[model samples]
Target: MSSAPKNEIFTQVVLEVFKVGGLLNIDGDKLTKEFGLTASRWKILGAIMLSDNPVTVPEIGRYMGQSRQAVQRLVDVMAKDGLLTMTENPNHKRAKYIQMTTKAVDIYKQLDMKQVKWAEGLSSDLSTSEMESALKVLKHIAKQISA
Candidate 1:
């Protein structure tokens, strides 16, 4: 019988990651659906909310590891829905700054509360330190991958 290559270990890890990612995506979708939002839209809103200043579509896209065009489409949809507004960007005439509207802020707050509850429910067994450690590990892995 032929032996599996050592690199197969890395391949298996990646496959498992993808599988878990799909499950997480489904859970995220269900959570966003409850707020009448999609995962992409929520991510955009989150990026804006966490930012210290108004951000451009490209900035949000880069932060989310998505394409500019994809982020622009979401920006357009949200703008049309009165969830966000696009203002002129002095830094880049070609790019517009995105800002959340009051209604969007309200929705975001509600979603934030719901997210907290969901996390609490899901992580009832995990201590706060454990969660922090997991986050730190994930961030480290993400930085390594990006590098």
Candidate 2:
């Protein structure tokens, strides 16, 4: 690709990604609110559930590209809300590992079903090939930017 055209495409992709992110956040908030959760809270719960083992607040912050203090405060609230529980981490004395409660597991299952339905409806007009291409491009851009 020519430099000018490539730059223009990059700019357009960046703008579109930002717009998509905003829209997803809006959708997330609406979807999660039905279950007494916000996007952020839901996301934190997902992080713990998705992990193979219990994760620390700092580890979650890194995974979510957020600050440790911010994640810590959110985790505390979630713990208080009975959505998460903290356990002693053998690796770190001060940094406790966070685990999801049974209630959280049930909620996440419901959320996952909702997400599947929402995604299927939203992508009804798009072909699998197109979705794969978009995913590839987005992953490439994410790696580049993160690096």
Candidate 3:
């Protein structure tokens, strides 16, 4: 309850969050490697998949909490690889909307399956309530950090 102890606890929690982020990055790359996706590519794909409609690169960037330029470069490479296609945006003239190709959708599905298995294995020792509690804490921290 003392200020110093509270500060130490906050510092420790922040350090743990950073540690978890680094580990998750490595895990994400490893899990997506077989699907020819890196963590970045997989993340963009996920953003697109979760979008309500085909979205512009800027929108994707916003959704992913990344820069538009970074998302645009990734979109260009993905388009070249035939994972997605850019179409003229009805809402915006210069900015085009991105949509996944069938190939991309199939790949996403495979990735989702892999994620399910990977998560199950990782959470095998943790109870559902524990996982939920952790999720809540993380989400709260994320909201605070963003704010």
Best by TM-score: 2
Residues 3-24 of candidate 3: C-alpha lDDT, one tens digit per residue: 6787798788889988987898
Clashes per candidate (backbone, < 3 Å)? 0, 0, 0
- In model 3, residue pairs whose N, Cα or C atoms come closer than 3 Å (at least 3 residues apart or on different chains), thus clashing, are none
Number of the top-ranking candidate, with lDDT as the measure: 3
TM-score of each: 0.85, 0.91, 0.87
* TM-score ranking from best candidate downward: 2, 3, 1
The number of clashing residue pairs in model 1 is 0
Which segments of candidate 1 are over 4 A away from where they belong? Answer: 1-13
lDDT tens digits by residue: candidate 1, 16-84: 878977787788788889667887798899999999998999999989988999999999999999999
Each model's Cα RMSD: 3.5, 1.9, 2.2
Task: Give the Cα-based TM-score of candidate 2 against the true structure.
Answer: 0.91
lDDT of each: 0.88, 0.90, 0.90
Task: Flag regions of model 3 displaced more than 4 Å.
Answer: 1-4
Pairs of residues at least 3 apart in sequence or in different chains that clash in candidate 2: none
Range of the 10 consecutive residues with the lowest summed lDDT in candidate 3: 1-10
Top-down lDDT ranking: 3, 2, 1
Which prediction has more favorable lDDT, 1 or 3? Answer: 3
Residue-level lDDT tens digits of model 2 in 19-133 = 9988998999999998888888888988888888779999899788789999999889988999999999999999998998999889999999999999999999999999999
**Residue runs of model 2 more than 4 Å from their true location after superposition:** 1-4
